[model samples]
Target: MAHPYVLLSAAVSLDGFLDDTGPERLLLSGPGDFDRVDEVRAGCDAILVGAGTLRTDNPRLLVNSAERRANRVAAGLPEYPLKVTVSASGNLDPDARFWHTGGAKTVYTTDRGAERLRGRLPGEVAVVALGPEVEWRAVLAHLGDVEGVRRLMVEGGGQVHTQLLRQGLADELQLAVAPLFVGEAEAPRMFGPGAYPPGRMRLLETRPVGDVVLMRYVPVAPGTGRLASAADRRWLAEACELAALCPPSRTAFSVGAVIVAADGTELARAYSREGGDPVVHAEEAALAKLDPADPRLAAATVYSSLEPCARRASRPAPCARLILEAGVRRVVTAWREPDTFVTAADGSGVLASEGVEVVVLPEYEERAKAPNAHLSPPPGRS
Candidate 1:
């Protein structure tokens, strides 16, 4: 998977407005802070802005830092990330300076506006429309698939940021708090609205650049950052809940669980459904997709959110056995099987022979148990 980072770079006053409702004007992020914003611009693979911002600031949206540009070139990256804008009503300006910026431009519009806006704006830039309206998921897929943008940086003009945040799409947030204040209630707020899930973001550093104090943050694993004061066990529990949401497969979403590690980077994800062979379980499903021979899974923790059964009637061995044999050290789980077909009890003993530490986060059990209610057996059958 490409590095999915949505960097929210905005200059908001103490009152949280990007700009007032007067004629489109640059509210904050003065010339000195523009240079500061360049660092953020250089780090992302794509730059996103709403059409309002395109019409208002007409930002060049390129990394002008001489040192940063040279480093990006040495790293074999294009001089600039792709520039993207979203407009639903097709009220975009063609002569806007955003067209002549460093990066190639793409406008995400609606199916209704595709032909009309294409004819009106009429430029070399590509125009893509998802459906009747703008679908961010389709847009995200386009960014990752067509544009090859792994890291996406979203500079908001309120509505777009609100949409992204409300849907829990944005991953990182970078705010440059200007010394000035725009107290008008009608001004655009930095973040519009959203129910943010539990995730850890660390302040890489904070420095005063020009009149604004620039703050940079990157998402860490949830619970590792000071910002993550509360643990959203519901989101964490959704690991198995999400697995249950997928169409049922032959192998019951287990026999193929996995944790991918190539270098220190890890990708712990589940397979939705299986086709070619008997479907594997979530743990083995993801693990099977990668080469266990790859060094990545060596030291990674596989949190299956369910106890790996020691024995299964349909499958050869159990996932626990497979995981241990893979040389994985840490296993975090939710439930313990009570049925006779699977009787590993703690199951950690099987892993202990291989010197693995098992952590049972029962908080996730309720989520994993929700779907298996039918197979759970009558309460007092014993």
Candidate 2:
């Protein structure tokens, strides 16, 4: 299922504390950093915080810049991003500033929580119940599918950030590191100890924002089994973009493939018709670049814009067989092969039958199909 691009945003002290254990909420971000956050909030479709943050900070979570709000409206977006919060117990205070100040509000909670919050919140506030337990995936799916939110910014209480990261759902992390230290041991921290996704996050950028340094990072580890991680989406999007580099194919579908190691290293990538080889498939070209006996191939994942070919006359061995021979056990693809060239082609089934984990994300189907649009039947035809 398609989910919003989840960006986890936070400001932490030098000692890795979110705030000091004081009577008042600790001010970690400088004025400049605060304005930067406002710009980010203005650009997003929604701003979310955990229930604990709402109660402790009592933040309105507004854009705070008139010009930025005007720009959002000018761009045909809501003046303020929708305010979102999660509470499994439905313990939110109706009079909190979070409820009274936002453009629109949504509460994601459990079934019992919904029962308690139904008539308590304002009539405009939407309360969505996600069955018995409030799962992070369910909240994200609802935000993307039902609310039409493409980009969501998560401003957190440590528990929420920890949950999202541990679940491999956070696409990006934007952390502002403050100079001062909150030495109190009982103070809140940015992340609690838990099993996070394996490997180091790819650092996107680092910059000085007043007294604080802002660092942006993206997760890179491919997800296990059939679950698609945010990193999986990033790699698949790259494959779709690579498809555009292929020589315009009339008889065959243009495709792209990437092989990534288990530790988030990209082993190889290639596009169809690369190096002027008319018969070379994307997966074949990428695999040819790596040694068959390479240790990484055993744990690597093959991401293709289109499904591997089940049958092809141009090549003696189809991509599916080549992948199996290469010792790859996991495959992520964007689109299933149409009947344009072969009838009843089932690369996915063939891979699955052999105990390979094949994951297809339909969200990228259109992108994978774009380069082959010319080969598709006309609008009125079958």
Candidate 3:
């Protein structure tokens, strides 16, 4: 049930309109911002749009930079990410640019709609029927398992964005705000009315790109994305709580770790001093319970109360090395490992250097540090 990391990318006017109501297509993004978006598209494994967008925009959705395409090829990827569309009615024009210009094309529709689209679309295109309705969850599962898509980019047409956000399926939102106003009520907006996920989205970063400003936000209650999902965050919190259950150690920092599958299932959970092994790291203990040949490990994520140890004397391999060896691709932690045990210890840097997706949620730092308050260094060195 693992799904690709979902990123919602959109450009909006100052007034939050996707475009003006004029007959011509409105250009909300500047030249520089357009290049930025192209770079984003190049990084994703697939790009998805709604049927409305396909009909209205008729976009080619290609990576325009030849250099970028070459880089993708060198990296053992296709020149362009796969193009995907979802429709309830399956009513689409075979001559649309979206059908002919992308590397590979896929259409997800209702079971009844699939029969109608199969004869209309080219033989090269894939038509998938997901139950009686177009379910986003099923579409994502197919993309991850069948299409081998890890990173998914969602280009908007209002309803699509709204549906993803409303379902808490989107991981990240990249909003490029142009310095103009589109006051027409008939114009499309970035999102339609829906009961969006509660709590404010966590703002990750903001930067100015030419005349437009780019703002990135991660979902607070994440189902999937580059950042940790709500479930991941909750698991990390539980890891911190587990730290309190560990036998207090004077020489080592008490920590907890949980290994989670890509589909948000907990694979294993462990804490320091687990099974009376004082030297065993939390991450190492958790991973020890899993089989070495488990294929799910490749897509699993490790959630730790504290950063995995980079250097340790109690064990031959550190937690960071163990995680990499286990093929866990992502790591989420509450706090960075302080230098109380080893000076200049940087577990995060080690994981990142090895190409692991490491994310640090500073909001839970205090909670993670609570159990180790006794290990704090004296106010001044003796």
The lDDT of each candidate is: 0.66, 0.95, 0.87
Q: Whose TM-score is higher: candidate 2's or candidate 3's?
A: 2
Position 336, candidate 3: lDDT:
90
TM-score: model 2 vs. ground truth: 0.98
TM-score of decoy 1: 0.57
User: Between 2 and 3, whose lDDT is larger?
Assistant: 2
lDDT, model 3, position 60: 90
Clashes of 3: 1
User: Can you rank all candidates by lDDT, best first?
Assistant: 2, 3, 1
Tens-place lDDT per residue, model 3, 1-382, is 4568899999999999998878778998889999999999999999999999988888999999999999999999999999999998989999999887859999999988898787798889999999898878788889988999989999988899998877867878999999999999999999988677654666889999999999998764423345445456567788999898889989998899988775556789999999998788889999999998899899887889999999998788999999999998888898998778799999999999989888887767889999898888788953
Off by over 4 Å in 2: 380-382
Query: Model 3 residue 124 lDDT?
Result: 90
Sort by TM-score, best first: 2, 3, 1
Which candidate number maximizes lDDT? Answer: 2
User: Model 3 off-target regions past 4 Å?
Assistant: 222-382
- What is the alpha-carbon lDDT of model 2 when measured against the actual structure? 0.95
Count of residue pairs whose backbone atoms collide, per candidate? 13, 0, 1
For this target, which candidate reaches the highest TM-score against the unseen true structure?
A: 2
